[model samples]
Target: MEAFTTHTGRAVPLRRSNVDTDQIIPAHWLKKVTRDGFEDGLFEAWRKDEEFILNRPERQGATVLVAGPDFGTGSSREHAVWALQNYGFKTVISSRFADIFRGNSLKNGLLTVVLPQRTVDALWELTEADPTVEITVDLVARKVTAPGVEADFELDENARWRLLEGLDDISITLRHEEDIAAYEAKRPSFKPRTLTV
Candidate 1:
């Protein structure tokens, strides 16, 4: 997973609430084992409508998504976070998010920002009024800001540290590699071995 510090870019305003994992990336897209190429399936169903906010040309290359409440509300699929990241969204801002979805996003380095409904609505309005307007999310400061809008967001301390340091679960464990090696070196010879001959 890539490290996330601060990101500033155009935000796509997606006003629909209760967006589920399946809507973010349909089940068919899940067949692939690799993380790449999921961007084609991001919002697959909605993209067919042509009028969907994501399908709009101006919304292309947007790195931030300002979505409605209850975003990522269904399923525990990590693919939802993969699709969002592959689609170039570094952060998602909403009033509320499913607990599982938020966890998945954080693990994959996709920052999920939760703010009050009023603040979320203001961000949507700002992005809708001018699609080119830039929104900045500062993880270190725990704040999201745009023209005439500034809101504080919450993030777990450990998750914040992981993102700031670009450390995934495995990377975190590897940080103590020297200690793990030393412990293994002192293990009894009769102890069950972890490796095959």
Candidate 2:
């Protein structure tokens, strides 16, 4: 997981509510155990529509996703977060989010910002009117800001620290590697044994 601090980029506005994990990344994509390359499967069904925002060339390389209420609201698949990260979205702004999905996103260093519905609607409208609109997510200040709007958001302190440090679960565990090694070395009853006793 890459560390997330302040990110400013073109925003990808997904103006729909109740976006479930299955809709973000369908179940068939879960067959691969590896975490790389889920971007292809991200919103696979939605892409078939040809008019989906993700298909718009102007939105390419957008690092922020401005979405509607109750985003990421489905099965507890962490792949939804993976898909977003692989697809290069560093931050997601919404009116609300599913608890489990939010947690998973934080664990993977994907920033999920919950702003009031009014703020979200404003962003959606701006992005819709102009594809060049960009938003900045300042994690250090816990704020999201656009040309004519600014709002405060909240995140868990520990999650914020983990993202700032780009520390995943394994990285956290490795921080205590020396202590673990010493504990194993001190285990009792480790003498060599003879074939016959």
Candidate 3:
């Protein structure tokens, strides 16, 4: 996963609530073996509608998503995060998010920010009013900054560290290379061997 320190870009305001994994990337798209190419599936159903916010030309390259409350409120699926990232969203801001979806997003280096409903609404208004408006999300400062908006967000230190260092689960386990090598050397010859670093 790519490291996330800070990001500044335009945002696409999505006012609909209860956007689930399937809506983010329909289940049909999950049949693919690789993570790439899901960009086309991001909001596949909604994209079919000519009036969808994402379909607007001005918001084409937006890297931030300002969504309604209860964003990502359905089943656990990492693909949702992938689709968003593939579709060019580096950060997501909302009043609330499903625990599983938030976890999936963070682990994949997609920052999920939670703020008060009032603050989120303000952001939505700002972006919707001006598609060229830029919003900055600073992970190190745990703050989001934009014109007339400055809000702090919280993220556990460990997750923050992982994102800063670009460490995934496998990368984390590999950090103990020497320790794993030492333990494996002392294991009983009769025991089955596990993969080593």
State the lDDT of candidate 3 residue by residue for 1-197, as single tens digits.
89999999999999988988889989899998997789999999999998899999998899999998889988887889999999899999999999999999988999999999899989998988888999999999999999999999998999999998888788788999999999988999777658753
- Steric overlap count per candidate: 0, 0, 0
List residue ranges in candidate 1 displaced over 4 A.
171-197
lDDT of 3 at 13: 90
Comparison by lDDT, 1 against 2, better one: 1
lDDT of 2 at 108: 83
lDDT tens digits by residue: candidate 2, 20-79:
999999999999999889999999999998789998899998999998899999899999
After TM-score superposition, the amount by which residue 47's alpha carbon in candidate 1 deviates from its true location, in angstroms, is 0.4
Better of 2 and 3 by lDDT: 3
The best-first sequence of candidates by TM-score reads 3, 1, 2
- Please give the RMSD of candidate 2 to the true structure: 5.5
The 0-to-1 C-alpha lDDT of every candidate, in the order given, reads 0.91, 0.90, 0.92
lDDT at position 10, candidate 2: 92
170 in model 3: Cα distance from truth in Å?
2.3
